[model samples]
Target: MPKPASASALFSGPFALATLSESDGPAFPALVRPDEKVLDLRVALGDPALTVRGLLEQWPTVLTRLHELASTERESGESYRPLAQFRVHAPVEPRQVFQSGANYRQHVIDLHVAHRAPGDERPEQERRAEAAEIMDRRAAQDLPYVFLGLPSSITGPYDDVTLPEWAQQPDWELELAAVIGRPACRVPVEEALEYVAGYTIANDLTDRATVFRRDMPQIGTDWLRSKNAPGFTPLGPWIVPSDSVGDLDDLQLNLKLNGEVMQDESTKDMIFGVARMVSYISQGARLLPGDLVLTGSPAGNGMHWGRLLRDGDVMDASITGLGAQRTRCVAEAR
Candidate 1:
């Protein structure tokens, strides 16, 4: 078993939104402030039924109110408690999850060269140059590759992820997830940013050995089997409001495995930016409040490092101002 990692302050600036549970009680939405204090939204908003998704449903108004509450200085009382007393959860319960695949410019090129087909005699430099050109062309003329993910796969930021007994090459893909606040259908690319509620982190785990269907080669990739296991997606420490997270295009995503940096890249390397990805997905399906659209992971995945995940390994994933997640891995009981 992996040793317990000490908890650190996950949120920054004035405040962020999170879901926390006290003992075994039900989880409640909260406003996380500085000094490791948390305010129960049910008590702060006077709505016992309040949830993170419910708050996003009324985002514009709720945001203003939350800002006011975060800015207020108050004495510790029934409404507020020390954050250490509670267990943190995935910030929002997303109704739908749309994940982008191979959307990073250099990540795609690297994968292409790394997984060259048999009997290919081309030089590595030549293959790399070809791959780069392919990515450039795709960026200029192709639609983003997006896929669906089940919400059941979501686990808390600090939860233990069970590596299925059958997994041979489990790998991690730390990504930036855009939380949707407003309902959107065929929204223009320019207007897509207006629908984003905030940003959070998601570690999209995959079993590389099962990613392709060997039995039926023509069927292509098998995302369902390789990426949707329960606890495969460790999401959120919290969601930082969009207004507070400036320069979405240049935000950095850093992932460390067992305290060693593996993936460290900027959002500027994405072939398709967040707004383009959201706008494209909305053209086909209506994006609802609390829905998550994961911007693709960057280079330096385990496959690149020749070090896939093993039992007892810990992954620390973080994005810009969205907070971090520390997920410990354990073998699944047979």
Candidate 2:
């Protein structure tokens, strides 16, 4: 079972929002329920520009209005539709994407152990201890590793993930993505949580084979070639308002590959939580509304299993309260 939020952390008015393109029309904002029913958010907000980014930019006021509407018109039978009725797009067309790497203690350890990299020359217990020590030092020193991702790689949660032939060892990384509401520049860690509008699920798909440049090993990892494939970042069934999501660190994340559980862990294991990641990123660059910060995935990726994603494979990623996303993988055209 998922952990509950504290009394102080509970949302005063609970609701989530999404973007969907219905009947081939332009995308519109929609209020989402955990049961998967949705309603036209524009009708509730009394606005026509049904864009999630617009709502996020004005979240301070819009959130209040959204709560009111969610209370009154929600139970009433008006404008609601089964989530399947609409063609879902990536919930937000984020202006920028910041993806975290090696943010999960167990995930990094799994990779180090599985690949037997230079650092793994020591015995199992010794290597694990060293890795844990490094993570502790990083947390104590207040540092995080973040990378840029192309917005063009974003795709719908339920969309098919097309794998390019160049990617031999394609993998899945189910992550919890933070959607920014307020612009932040060097925001303090204490005030950083307020900048979050909501949370969504992101499957940060990767190609394990290309992660390290064999030709230029000294140049280091190549996030672009390994992770920025078309539709590689499958995001959102909906963005549950951060307030409504309860305890940020206690949420559970699970990913299944064809009915088998591949990744199952709690956000409690995150070496860097949402607030820290946000505050750290803000110090280096300004974070604008609707920009995404993907907290890294937990352990048990395909790479750890020595079984990469295959053509026609299915991935179902779920984060407690935030909702679940299903993506089927297909080989790219030759």
Candidate 3:
């Protein structure tokens, strides 16, 4: 006979919750009061019956029950501990990380000027030609502009961002990252959202000098290097479930550089929205559970104004209801 489920079973490995108390070290279910730590539904509910593959297969039921339990505990005045006591990690190991580039109209224009010759035609004509070419390339490229990042590039919320000494122009890209929940191949644009697990914030850091080299091959390997620098992509804080963020098209996103608002825009402004990007990318590659796709960033990136990140800079990026991610920039230790 199969063993029945118990509260203890829920808190076992593969599913465990931890609390961050101001006065205590990290507290797990076995080490401290289950009620005292901040609720980590993914960690708090583990099932021996489910294999790693099966866990996501049964995620809906598991997540539903987990949320109910956590909410109930919170409603009862359980005196839950604070988040300051412990740090959070990436909730899942993403199989692949896909990022988009130059997807915003303003960003495209900015790049044209930055990359154009000093006297490359009249400014108005150059802008028009560049815009038209970008539009034309969109149809020809067909595929979404994607670059891969090493897992080492990813860091969790509240992590420090290391700026390499050679990084002359460090910039921040505030983007929405969607986590794939199911295996999908050649998914239609209309049905793409159904495969999503949730959304989180992503900072697509870039080094301008390396990316905008005029002598480098435009369509070759250098493009990838510029986009995939180490410690370039930072994600997390929480994976706001898809259901919780209804009408994905309407959400507002913002980025603050040291308490000053920088990028502020709505998802509605995206030239290629999430659904299309997902469906298009899937036609070329299969998306699996924990795989992440970063929808492109909006205008207002520091690169446009010749302002790059420096040591001691703080970046706080957030999406509506999804929570915020903050990172402090420090010089790469010599």
Could you tell me every candidate's TM-score relative to the true structure? 0.95, 0.91, 0.79
- Number of the top-ranking candidate, with lDDT as the measure: 1
Question: What is the clash tally of candidate 2?
Answer: 0
Candidate order by lDDT, highest to lowest? 1, 2, 3
Model 2 misses residue 207 by how many Å?
0.6
Q: Which stretches of candidate 2 lie over 4 Å from their true place?
A: 1-14, 74-78, 118-123
- Identify the candidate with maximal TM-score: 1
Better TM-score candidate (1, 3): 1
Please give the range of 10 consecutive residues that has the lowest summed lDDT in model 2: 1-10
Worst 10 residues of 3 by lDDT: 1-10
Clashes of each: 0, 0, 5
Better-scoring candidate (lDDT), 2 or 3: 2
The C-alpha local distance difference test score for the whole of candidate 3 amounts to 0.65
Q: How many backbone clashes does candidate 3 have?
A: 5
Q: Give per-residue CA lDDT, model 3, range 1-334, as digits (tens).
A: 1111221222211222221223344323211222334543324455323332234455556556645665554433343453434545544557688777656666666666666667676776767677768856774666567766666677755668888877778788899888777888999998998888677778888877777566756654454556566667777655656776656787777888877888888887666778888897888899887788888887778866667898888888877756667888889988
lDDT of each: 0.88, 0.84, 0.65
Task: Arrange candidates by TM-score, descending.
Answer: 1, 2, 3
